[model samples]
Target: MTETAAEATGTAAPGTTAEPRTTAELAPGVVIPLIGLGTWPMAGGEATGAVARAIANGYRHIDTAENYNNEEAVGEGIRRSGIDRGDLFLTTKFNRQWHGRTAVREAFGAATRRLGTEYLDLFLIHWPNPSQGRFVEAAEGLTRLAEEGLIRCWGVSNFKPAHLRELQAAGLEVPVNQVQIDPETQQPDQLAFHRGHGIVTAAYSPLGRNGSFLSAPVVTGPGAEYDRTPAQVVLRWQVQSGRVAIPKSADDRRQRENLDVFGFALTEAEMAGIDALDTGAPPRLDSDEFGH
Candidate 1:
């Protein structure tokens, strides 16, 4: 594993901006950016502008999903950024309605067309609808897509350790696992499980969506000491703790501020402080019962 951006750079210099950096490698050719722009509950022109602005401000990774209903806007934003397709790492998910082998292929095609790209940097199954009992079939579909060169890598979201083990038992390989992770919903066990399996854990809602976690002294004290916002402190904790964080912000200033986390390093004590804030309960929807 490579050193995190903060670990490599020491402390951030005042008024200095750092380049986007990769925090983990999913495979031989697939390197995931430490921070990515998460697009959910954002759509149409708003999503387009936010994505374009984020890319212009040094965000190379963009995470969207079929259920987000903004693939077109995301694609347009990528176009507006004027950055080459090869330089960006784009990820989108297959809708739950599109499970099973055939549906997976169809959904992927539609997503690529909406995303306006020939191939996706990474693609995922948005949810594991276990009740449907088609996740394995969907995984097989994604495998075919990968072998067909339609997607560079494939994985799952909202998957528990047992769910991952199930897929593994089916002889499938998952490179990434996107899940809701935050100080309040720490998921240390899940993180450990992913690391044990060589899977990259992508954290959604890393800042706790309701913004309540920002008030924790563990977060605020670190922000005050580092001259960073609570959001920055939380995102920094994610990167430093070795997880890919996709924080959603439509404002250009906030987007730029979020990407600026690489300038400083969080102390072991501070990291432990934040770790102590975990309530051990997930902040949002539970995967097993969700999207069923």
Candidate 2:
């Protein structure tokens, strides 16, 4: 395998801003920005402006979902930025109601229309919906869509190792898997499975929600030494560990801070220190029983 962005690290003079062009190739000819803007829990005008400002701040990757109910706003933000659509990486996922070969296409068309885009950089099944038991067919649908050139790449979210094994057994390939990962709730087993299968791990909620752990000595110690915020320390660790991180922030300064991580590299000890913070708790939402 070619060296993934996650395996590589770069440095800049401390306290200076570095342009974030780091990306991981999830599949042939499909490269995703390592740091992306996650648009969820934001809607309407808020979503639009956050996305627009994110692009203006040099974010080239944007993540949204059909369930987010804000693809229209995200698309508008893209237009407002006046950047070429081809220059950005846009990702979205659909609910289980759209699970199936033909229904997946319907969902794709609807998402593109809502986002006002010609095609997507990546499309994902939001959850396995294992009880529904049609995710294999859904994965097949996304695969067919990719073959048809409707999407550059396709993947799944919140899928555990067992769910991925099913796809493997069905003779399907998963190029990427987005799940929750942070210093706490590291999901090492899922990540190990992804690495063993050459699947890229995309971390949603890269920062813990109600993240009291940011104040932990392990994280804050690095922040002080690197002249970065505690959140930046965690994001840097995520990147150094070879995972893609999409952190959400509607505030311009916070967005810029999120992107400023590439300039500083973390030491192995610091990396381990943060890694030691993993609580081994299951992800907040279980794909087995909880999926839209």
**TM-scores, in order shown?**
0.92, 0.95
Candidate 1 residues 23-90, lDDT tens each? 56776667778899999989999999999999999999999998899999999999999999999999
Shift in Å, residue 7, candidate 1: 10
lDDT at residue 200 of model 2 (Cα atoms): 86
lDDT agreement with native, every candidate: 0.85, 0.90
Give the CA lDDT, 0 to 100, for residue 180 in model 2: 98
| The best candidate in terms of lDDT | 2
lDDT digits (tens) for residues 1-292 of candidate 2:
3546555445444433355447878777888888999999899999999999999999999999999999999999999999999999999999999999899999999999999998999999999999999999999999999999999999999999999999999999788899999999999999989989888899999998989889999999989997889999999889878889999999999999999887777777777899899889999988899999
State the displacement of the C-alpha of residue 116, model 1, in Å, after optimal TM-score superposition.
0.9
What TM-score would you give candidate 1 relative to the actual structure? 0.92
Clashes of each: 1, 1
